[model samples]
Target: MITVFAEAGYEVDRHFDDGVVMLGFDIDPTRRSQAVMEAREHRAEARSMAELLTPSSVAVIGASREWGTVGHALLEHLIDGGFTGTVYAVNPEAFELHGIISHASLTEVPEQVDLAVIAVPHEQVDAVVDDCARAGVRGLLVATAGYADDGGDGLARQRALVHKARAHGMRVVGPASLGLVNTDPAVRLNASMAPGLPERGALSLFSQSAGLGVLLYASARRRAGSACPR
Candidate 1:
């Protein structure tokens, strides 16, 4: 009997040959077993999310030139953090922002984009998601807050946004998220709107409450500053 299992987007086939279990393909048994364990541990949805967190290139779909907006802050953070990967700023009305070339849409950007950070108004999120999907973006970080957080009609729109992302095989981080940051020096990704960057350390923090997370980062920065010799 041959049994096939799909896990974390990977398909594994096991065959019972003469009372012995064997993998259908010519793969190292040890490696195959490890893969099976990993697959079982993570689901398909989570696998895509993992990719979203470590994208090499990111596009800011609602990037803005205005200083006070979330889109502007996020773009500034990425630049100040020294993110080594490519960054694209998308806005139909803008030609340039902070010296970076701004495209009218995601599709207009010539390079491949791995992730899209949407900071547009809630009403515009769905259309932007559609644009991102058409542009082949695999991950989405929706920083816009008006959706489900607003209740009623907003919830329905949020649902539609998620449905569209899933249909295109893309992973969404949040519709009302504080954003994300990776302290790795090589990656140097800071996708959040936090006041400042926290010092790199062994410990990593994940907070559901955006306010608390911002405060935590601020405290970390203070602690790091305090520890430094004057």
Candidate 2:
């Protein structure tokens, strides 16, 4: 390590005391402060990951009663996958879905939502993200498309969504994501539109395209399965 540092323009020194060895580097104050900031950001990112992967509770913003819809499939994925956490369904028009009581909005739910899955339309996405931020949702998984994929205006829309989530100290997965699935036995979470939660394995896959993700997951399952959370 001392040799590597010396090659990288750092003043490296070695010291010994009582048979103990230690290496030191002469670091500039500006670089030291920058390193501190980078460490802080990495810690924050890890916290967000923990919240997103192992939330105590979750809310599906656009959960639906209709069987063929994306919202319906996402809700079913969570329930059928044997997720142990509290699941809240949010739909303005319906009072109940799959026997669980549904709230009119994110703020209407009584419990603290650790993760919010936004499956609403592109036009309604910005408002829904704002509501989730205001309600203090720790992490977000946006399944809504049309932003960034549509080319011109979508770029700006996607940028805004990310900026808002960061401003609130929240982590956001995607503006055009398929969903997320964790096959861990302790926390079985499938917040995506994929057909089934693959069996627990060491493989972890992430992608922006739902179609390709579904294909990859199927292939992974054929070989013993994987954990894919986009």
Candidate 3:
């Protein structure tokens, strides 16, 4: 006689004719199976991140009209960088910015937002994240600071923000990041807060320090001289 029990392709227990019973010997297979699942999950997440990086549409939350501000600079960069995708500026106080209509909130936007760039204060990060989750945003780029790097309660806040974003199946880029940029002609997304746009090139850069990255980008632009050879 033989008895077997399985779950989702995993064998839980087995019994054979010689009165032999396998108790928890399935641990190895279970671990291996879990590892496989996790690998697949990581692959899926990588694909999702790629899509997010090249979204067809983006919404900049906490956009502002005031010059020199992070929110304003991000919006300006996106526009000046020649991003072909739809761009939405969200600000409750302003109806328009840089000639584009500004929605009062993410929920108020009529179309779906592929990625949401948040520039609000750290204190308001939670609420904005909640709004983005409710709006079904696929990716988040948080430009606000005052978390983790600030230490103490700030670290907890950053952890909570990540947890909430994960719970809603959304990916977060940063709590105090300089944001990202893509040089693809079809999707020219310059979401960073750099002083100037870097010339388009094949080289993609990732920097650990925001200040250093901006300086490097500026230097590259100077060397490239207005246009980067394709």
Q: In terms of lDDT, which candidate is strongest? A: 2
TM for every model, in the order presented, reads: 0.78, 0.80, 0.79
Among all candidates shown, the one with the greatest TM-score: 2
Deviating ranges (above 4 Å) for candidate 2: 1-43, 208-212, 225-230
Rank the candidate models, highest TM-score first: 2, 3, 1
Encode model 2's per-residue lDDT on 1-230: one tens digit a residue.
66656655556678998898888865764564566667878997777677788988989999998988888988988988888899999999999997799999998999899999988998998899889989989889988888888898999989988998889988899887787788777888988777677777777786667678778877887776344332
Off by over 4 Å in 1: 1-46, 225-230
Please write out the lDDT profile of model 1 over residues 113-135, one tens digit for every residue. 99899999987888888888888
RMSD to true structure for each model, in Å: 6.5, 6.3, 5.2
Better model by lDDT, 1 or 2? 2
Worst 10 residues of 1 by lDDT: 1-10
Model 3 regions more than 4 Å off:
1-42, 215-230
Clash numbers, per candidate: 0, 0, 0
Whichever of 1 and 3 has more lDDT, that candidate is: 3
TM-score of 2: 0.80
